[model samples]
Target: MNKVSLLSSSVRQQSLQAVALLVFLVMGLSGAMGPTLIPAIRVVFGLGLSSAMTVQWIPLVVSGLSSLILAQLLHRFGAKAMVLGGLGLMTVGCLQVRLAILAPFGLDARYGLMLLALAVIALGTSVIQVAANLLVVQLGHARTASARLTLAQSFNSLGVLVGVSLGTTFALGAKTTTAPTMALGIGQAFGWSGAINAAVLAAAAMVAAGAWGVSRTSQAGQAPIRAALGSGWALAGAGGIALYVGAEGSIGSILIPFLHQKSVLNLTLEQAGHYLGWFYWGGALAGRLAGTWLLHRGAPAKWLGMAALGAVIASALAALGSGPVAGYAALTIGLFNAIMFPVIFSITVERSAAPSAAVSGLLSTAIAGGAILSALVGWTGEHFGFAVCFLVPMLAYGLIALFAGFGALLPSVDKAPQDSRMTSSVGNLSERT
Candidate 1:
């Protein structure tokens, strides 16, 4: 390709990157809105704690399974089809929940359908996430892969922030009780949060559908999924992403509750949320900025190691205390997690001997760890306490530390023998050293 053609191709490629970012924002919003509304949904539907948590787990399973299944879908039908399909699934799921509100059915019947809706949304978001993550890395310039993914994930955090803010606000406003009472009865406050989420999902689907043509042009051919799964570095990288995402989600998800349980500042639910939001928003923004900076400084693995250490320390501090200080520590771990998946993913993609789609599929499947780890923490919280519950994430962080220190020591998974003809299909297409 000539210089102009290359430039135009680059622009088209980055446009797809932008689309991926949009998908993350929508999925992130949908994923978070359900959790925010759980309290209200539980009260209105008369569900128990384990039941509410079970609703949360459903999404994780759906998302993970979809990621695993989607590789074939993308390989067969293409990323555009998968992206639009995911949006369609999420739209259907949200509508199901919205319809439940208007129905005359019994509470148990209504809640059961709502739970099913959440699962469908989860599966849809998972498909979108898998496709988007893979596309950004595959289509973008090779050297800038980390930068591309980081930019997209920053938007993911933005979605979470929006979801939490809107969910909490609407939930609180829907109640007739005093703010303090409403906050205390968290379940009563989240009823309308569900409806609000449905609106957002609809808007997102429209945007995704409009951009479908642009993203379809970016899809490229790739090797088989089975071959990619067999690669060692690809699997390790996926494991790294899984551990990082799970630890980050588990810690962030519980920060507000952990803060409210304390006596030091004795924060109300709203106040606790304000503090928790800062932790999430702060870590997300700061970590992404720092990750960009560190990528430029060289030695990405060293940076990864340092961040893992920070996680270990943060977990320890949060474990030792329960008040404002512990809350801060737990939230700050977002900073550590911010760069993890991007950094690890970049490394994996660079090292992959298999097709880009295969690598992306493995990483996407790893996201299921969020569901597994979250449930594990929930179990621990029930048996012991929140502080102790964090021990599971602490272990995940520790494993990340080991990976950062020794990732290079591990062998590559590509079955192809080392050859000068070996080439990277995605990004700038630069020859490996």
Candidate 2:
């Protein structure tokens, strides 16, 4: 290739990776929207709080199962197929939810269909996450893979921020209006459902475009699933990922409730809730941006260790202290959490003997810890106190610190030559297409 052709090819490669970032952004948006969607569902369906909570778990359990299944499937089909499949499923799922809500059906019927829609969405999310994580890693230089993924994840945080904002605006802020066909209050809360549908459709379209652009690209070779399952380091990395997600989820889940306590920040429920986006997720966004630079300059494993240690100290301060000190400590943990996932995933994939898809699948499956750990924190908070519940995440973060330290001792794999060959192969394929 000529100099200009080479430069253009590089640009095309990066642009293609941006598609994965967009998918991540949509994933983040969908995730943040779930909590906001629940209350709206409650109002629309006339369900109690306990019943509404089921909406949260359905996606988590489904996504975990989907990741495991798709991981195995990747051995037969390439990442391109998986990405396209995920996007199609998500689009269909979102459409289903929207249509179900609009249908003039009874509450029970609508609720059942809504649950099905969520399951489809979650399954699609799992497939996209597994494929995209591997795709971003394959598209970049092996040395800066962590930084690349972190940068892409920064957009994920941005998506969360935007999703939260939109959900609040359209869902919570929706005004009640009369509908000739339905009950008086039903039409008002349904606005959020419509908004969610529109957003999902837009995201799906973007992903479809991305999928088309990369259709000719090739995925990394698959290693034996048995080898991946048996590797101690991969298992440890998976455990660490689960722990990290659990810790982060536990903290975010309780932040508002904890802040409402008189002994803590004693903020009103509204004020405390607002801090979730401003401090918790905003800090996360900042951390990822900073982490991108840090990972480029320093060792990813060492940085992961230091960030986990920071989280441990912050969790301790939040647990042990009261007033603003505790509140700030609790929120700042998001900053430390920002880079751990990408760093852990990159390091784990590099060190593992299994193929990238297998390692990614194992790591992605570990995200179920969010549900598990959140339940633990809730149980602990109910029995003990919310402040004391910080102990759970503190313990989780401590373990992550140890995992990162151990990971630092392992040998790194150089996949640059393989990546370059893949890139050339992709270029040739693209030209033929």
lDDT of 2 by residue, 307-333 (tens): 999999999999999999999999999
Q: Candidate 1: where is the Cα deviation over 4 Å? A: 1-14, 46-48, 172-223, 408-433
lDDT string for model 1 (288-372, tens) is 8667766666666777888898989889888887676777787788777787877787678677777766677777777776777
My TM-score estimates for the predictions, one after another, are 0.82, 0.82
Candidate with maximal lDDT = 2
Off-target runs (Cα >4 Å) in candidate 2 are 2-8, 36-57, 75-77, 91-115, 170-223, 414-433
Residue 304 of model 2 has an lDDT of 94
Scored against the true structure, residue 154 in model 1 reaches a CA lDDT of: 77
- Give the range of the ten consecutive residues with the poorest summed lDDT in model 2: 177-186
Angstrom error of the Cα, residue 290, model 1: value is 3.1
